[model samples]
Target: MKAKKSLVALAVLGTLSGASYAQSSVTLYGIVDAGLLYTSNVKTAEGGKALLQLASGNLNGSRWGLLGSEDLGGGLKAIFRLENGFNVNNGTLGQGNRLFGRQAYVGLASNTYGTFTMGRQYNALQDYVATLQLVSALTQFSTHPYDNDDLNNTYRTDNTVKYATPKLAGFQAEALYGFSNSTNFANNRAYSLGANYSNGSFNLGAGYARSQSPGAIGGAIVGNPSSATPSNPLLDAARVDQWGVAGTYVLGSLTLGLLYSGSLYTNSTFTLAAPRGTIHFQNYEGSVRYQVSPTLMLVLGETYTTVHQSGESGHYLQTSAGADYYLSKRTDLYLNAFYQKASSNLQANIDGAGGAASGSSQAVVVAGIRHKF
Candidate 1:
């Protein structure tokens, strides 16, 4: 009888262990995007020349990632993610070639409480306000001047801790802090806060972020200066502040979006002329998306950006249009076009294009296919 009881107890324990293992799961996901690109002009020492080439990540960046979750009982869970960015055309790693440059984080989550995560992660601007751009068909191609406000997720914060509140009454909030890990304490540190609200057909978001002595510490807010290719040229700044507000409304199959963002780089070392003070950028954008049919969608957008320096200023007016045809639930074909005009003798440089134009105007057209799995 004693031996039989021990055997039953061991069987029960084994069954419980198997049940726990069943509660854990891991998923692999990725996106591949490639396209043919045509640029009206590419700046060169000889002036400007039209160019055609194969481009990667026109609508979305090519990337792959693993997401995992383990249930901890009572509405709690342990979660983690590792994401990598790459160039599909050259088969090269993106984001300075880090193994998991896009995102890598682990956290605990509770259905009743909020979530707390730590690792290399996106700032509040990228979490909240940047999502508003998804309603636009041109998504990544319509970034605000050099993505200075980080609306395009140009970079991620390192050694960071973040917390997000559970949605209540259509409102949610989040905050983050990134440590410099230097003896100086404050050098290259970063912080951000953001909030979102949604009601019926309307959604709104606002965010603010600041970094001190960005790029001064390795793997900090902007990553290492030597390895990271920051979208904004003025990364060597004493301080960087970014803030933005965006809103979107869905009316049946049509959506409208509007956004405003600002980036301020103070005491920057990179400058066109002497006596560098501050470089400030303000961006305003409006976009509309229409679903023409079950499988076709179209978008139109315009952006006006202004830049100011110690004693001079410049302006940019950009227009964008695109169409997407869904080949299936996980694949699509897209066509996008962009034109930009600049003032104050500044050259027009469309994002993702090879180079800037020698004149004040530039245009680009791209046809691509995207697959998600």
Candidate 2:
């Protein structure tokens, strides 16, 4: 079967090539999703960016890009994709000025078995972490404020080789391994494996991930000669750990989902000159959603987080409710609002430590639209 397909592909490419007209195809595809936004307490009490301002991603980020796959030969194929993310209002590049920041990966696919690829890849947590957020396409209202730990970025490993299993009987699994890009102990890296099962109106999935850091990023300003600005070290052995599970089931016009996540910081210490011994930090969460109609639906979500400080203990409850409406296949509009409250060792916040944080409680509300193509 593979040999026959290869010959057919070569024959088609040969007939289309060496022709008079431009035979190569470079098509463009992307999303330009943006809308009105209203945010409260955007900054600190020190007169930071706190106030209602127009924002992007009330639904999605504004972006555009290209994708194409060429017939190289045999059963093998040559494929490349470039996607860029940007702010629509002022036209600024998103994801830190990366041309293909949204996604930049190239590799081959097989008709049978599976496909292998490499690049900066989204992690398993993204697919299984917090429910309310991932379900909303990683909504801003639900992703942060609860855990700035960024189980989001930095967590997304770089230089990764990923394998996606063929979808069979509504079942699929993904495996990924990332390189630390270091000279020694390449094994000192990160990786994850996750699988999803979906059939009819029911769906479920679970995942696991592990990553490490050489050390914390404290600098001269904190009082260290090694840092250009003088730095601090909470713990020379500080490392970041994260893992989570998510599941969702749909019936008729309604769908329900749940998620949980946690992190561990070993040898978590103070950013001060006098460091303490092995301290620790962790987090937990849960959420759910329901659909009212195809164009309009209701969302009720909540997350609970607990932190065990080296010397203090704290926790917070975040509850939210909102509505989502699909304007079209490429466009979606939503309004989300959430409230947060903290307790137990409430105000004694951690200093400039590289461990889990227990910041002050705040509320967030936003209404926006997203479009994809």
Candidate 3:
């Protein structure tokens, strides 16, 4: 009788353990990317000079993270993700040196409803519109001039609340709001809204974002307005508004995409002339990707941008092309090249280089490898 009781107790405990294991799970994942880069016409006081160096995150930022979820029954779950960004070359943190600068969010997800999250996160523009666009979807080198549209996710919002709707009838929608946490309302605040639709082989998306006093010192937004970082130019403005539309069509092994965006900086300090009023930028882009084989792919993209500021207008044209070869499911090699030209008094910023420009042209080439685990 004691043996029988012991066997029953062991079975009960094993059942409970299996249930507990099934109710929760955690995963760790990461990507590492690094490359050698060469740039032509790096601006300097004396003259434009070439640059050669080791680069990190040529196609995607290096990152590692933990994602976990606990089943809460009734089709609901508690979820959290903590992601970190770092430089592969220097083995240093990337996003403001914060351990989880890339993303840190926790929320509840309902299979019947949707998801609600709060923390540092990407705006809706990045989640919906930008990801579908070719310039932002392709290699990092393909971003619009200076990433003026924020399509490359130049900055992320902190202290944010976000809601994402479950896909219904091939449609999905999401929104985000970032608080300033200041006495003066609207100071350093940001908001975004976006939606996407997918049907058959066509996908379309659009989004809008606005920020007040973005990059203001000691404000909700962090960074120095005058400092030039690899991913951020830190252009200060009283108010900024941006909107974009993007679409992609897939056919067999080829995909084509189109993107358009407009950004307006009001009462800006980054303008060329004094008495700063507003600086406007409009971008148009197109891109194509072809899978030559199961393991090889080719991509090409182009963007044309117009800048309007203080009765002056400038034109910029940027082109990017690349080839990617996959050695394994989690590892790949790539070669990407980009060229940008400016006309009509436009300062040649050239893909966030923040250099001195002798002329209106800049070019860069990057060869790299990426691994995911």
Q: What is the C-alpha lDDT of each candidate?
A: 0.86, 0.56, 0.82
- Between prediction 1 and prediction 2, the one with superior TM-score is 1
Candidate 1 lDDT by residue in tens digits, 1-373? 9999999999899879869674877899999999999998789888889999999988888999999998888989999999999999989999878889899999998889989999999988888899996423584768877777888877889999999998999999999999988888899899999999999999999999999988674636763346436535576788899999999999999999999999998887666323577889999999999999999999999999998888788889999999999999999999988889999468788876878788889998999999999
lDDT: worst 10-residue window of model 1: 223-232
Model 1 CA deviation exceeding 4 Å by range: 1-22, 134-136, 223-231, 272-275
User: Lowest-lDDT window of 10 residues in candidate 3?
Assistant: 226-235
lDDT of 3 by residue, 1-373 (tens): 9999999999899779968665877899999998898888887776889988888887888999999998888999999999999999889998778899889999999987999999889887888887887644446767777677788877788889999998999999998998888887678888999999999999999999988887654444563556443224434777888899999999999999988999988867665423456888899988899999999999999889998887778888988889999999999999888888888476565664335357888888889899999
- Candidate 1 RMSD to the correct structure: 5.4
Q: Best candidate, lDDT-wise? A: 1
Q: Can you give the lDDT of residue 130 in candidate 2? A: 35
Query: CA shift at 168, candidate 1, in angstroms?
Result: 0.7
Evaluated with TM-score, which candidate comes out highest?
1
lDDT of 2 by residue, 187-252 (tens): 336677777777886666666665554242221011122443222232233454556666666766
